[model samples]
Target: MFRLAAAAACALALGLAAAPAPTSAAERLTLTSQYGPGKPQTLLWERFAEILERERPGAYDINIVTNGALGGEKEEAEAIRLGAITGAESTIANLTTWVPLGAVLDLPFVFQDAAHIERVLEGPLGDELKAAYRAEGFETPAFIIFGARHLLGKTPLTEPGDVDGLTMRVLQSDLHVALWRSLGANPTALPITEAYTALSNGVVDAMDMTKSGFEALKLYEVAPVLTETAHIWAVGVVYFDANFWAGLDADERALFQKASEEAAAYFNEIAAEEQEAALQRAMALGASRAAVDQELWRAAVAPFVEDFVRNMEDPRAVDALEMIQEAR
Candidate 1:
């Protein structure tokens, strides 16, 4: 019996030795964003990956692709839908193509401030948006503010009337087109990739973007005039591939969610500060800056906002709009 037991132990040891060794690190997953390295959008995910790896070492490996290495924003969104990629930092405006109800968030003058945005998005309205995104097979775990969008124009845009007859580069989103048309501007739809050339060649006299966006794209070099329209507070939606998310165990998923939220909060606090600094730097670099009558701009766009909410298909849009307007 002792010899038999020793033989069994030897057999077990040999079998264990023959088996493949366990991997020390997890397989890497991809995270794609249009923003290239050193951009704030990419920096958010950089921080997220760092936190995730530090907290759950060897459990998750994230390979981040910036500068639209995988594809443009719309293409990346489709990849997420098809499970071709793990996740993307998509603009809320571009996401409208998949989830049309998301356009409500792009409505001009909808949000009061970052605090107001947080309150509405973290509460019932946010819940509804999440459900809407999930219905379309995507999930947004967190939202990062880009900053209040302003007008960057070769000509000064100090008031709503200044936009009249000007050719402006608007986002490809439907709502953006409609908003600019309502303001009496000849809206030209252009991708960010083509915006610099269009601005330089005088194809478009004006364009709207946040301070960071202007700095990232170096638009101020061409447009030269920064008008603080604060028309809309642009936000980046953190979208995860639903199938990829479902494949993860509960613990792994929780780590992702926690990291996203923590990274979002960290960036949110500094977004405003960065916007201010970006504007200062642009001015120092020879760009002119001016402030518009925000009240007049809001009033000019009020009709469009009212019509947008009234025409929304989602029953939640009404409540969401109300909730945002009423948020302190």
Candidate 2:
């Protein structure tokens, strides 16, 4: 009888211990990044979640999903808009589907260097861009750097002429198509997932990508050549769902914004360090590196830039371009 009573007492103790403790009202948010684990983009979101939880204590809990577990950027973006998910990361180029002016960031040669890109995105130009996102129902525009995009090709790109007649993979943005076409390459729009197979099988001859992307996708094994074109300052922006954001109090919003800003600055530093490492890794894997003929490539693409600017319907496009150029 004593053993039976002791067992009953121990069962009661275990039950109580297994039950969750009572806590204050807490909101749960889901944040997703498409990048795989250990990539800077994935790590940045992880740190952001940590900051949010630390700031709010039991008031909020943020769950992060990495490696496109939810979906690719576009699919995740649509989900966020419908309030299916709380938030996701996106490139300015990809955001063009919602905000046409987002293409301004993807235009080649607009940013002279990383510093110039940073200044524009952190200044009035960025303010305008953020306002556009907010107007369209996204909130807290946080910029994430993916480093400078370079040419990854099956053959060496010694001059602008080398790209002529070669089929190159491009993003799903019209501007990318126009840019590559202007360079005399036939631009093919392929989802990044298919790029490795396409390159290895000779379906496409070249692609424009960042060191981080090249390394992450292991495309060097197929392409084997990295040209330092640094054509555009590749960037991705993170925005929250408008409904979810509006539900948050001012303090909550401020806390998130602060965390995003600090995290972006931190990410840029890490990207700089990773850039050298990615280059070394690619070279060690038997990839050849080459210098681009910038002047020649710029001269070839100048007409396209002018035509693009002349066709902008929004006057804000002119102002944005001016601000970007002055930063250089």
Candidate 3:
């Protein structure tokens, strides 16, 4: 009888101990991007969110904010720094705040193809760049390469001569300014959000942006001609604030990093496919698309590249340029 009673007591104790505690809700994380939802940037974030939810369960959740709804890239970056936001997908141009040396990546014609970009960015050099951001109080999970930048204009641009005396909208980067100036176009730096209106209002006759950006911004509606000059292959970095990152336990951090890298690879593959699709879609929408004369663009931009190389004091910048050229 005593044995039976003891067994019952033990079973009851086990049952009480095994009862699950209330599952805490997942912590919601917000990721801000300059592009609109349904675009490439937001698509990457969505994939990341899915992976995070699957891997971390109740650990973390991601909410993507796009279309400058949270403000422009610069503003969003500042928010991340101030701990007002958790993460952001930012262009190298905007990332210049944390790592000024990153601006070198914006130079025209530096990265020849996606393979070349991937090799450099996922290799030792890319690791170094990631560390640079870490030093500035951020966590860089992975860098994703986008399609090559091309010139889209209201007027046809087959060669450098066509751009002469044209007012061109460019990102506020010294490298971009130098490249545009060398090509004889008047360079005006403006935020990406204002680019569409500026183009429609005739504030700028030409702009350099990826084919996907052209489609997303509906720039094709106004600028009917897109020249595949392929001047620059831009890259976007996924970053988290160091404080928020450090708060995560080891397993959570590993899960986030793995998910981010996978999402970045997915973004690169999708971006390549979308680049051709965007061009085809533009043509269907009554836009004329053509390839630029490489020789002419190279000739016009060579001097600018030379000047840039001479002025750059960072050996890593020079090495990155050379490595990319060699890979090409």
lDDT of each: 0.79, 0.77, 0.79
Candidate 2 lDDT, 61-146, residue by residue in tens: 56667666555566666667766567777777777777778788887877777777888888998888888888877875588777
Prediction 3 global C-alpha lDDT: 0.79
lDDT of 1: 0.79
Report how far off residue 244 is in candidate 3 (Å): 1.6
All-Cα superposition RMSD per candidate: 11.8, 10.5, 13.1
Which regions of candidate 2 are displaced past 4 Å? Answer: 1-26
| Candidate 3 pairs with clashing backbones | none
Structure candidate 1, residue pairs in collision? none
Clashes of 1: 0
User: What is the TM-score (0 to 1) of candidate 2?
Assistant: 0.88
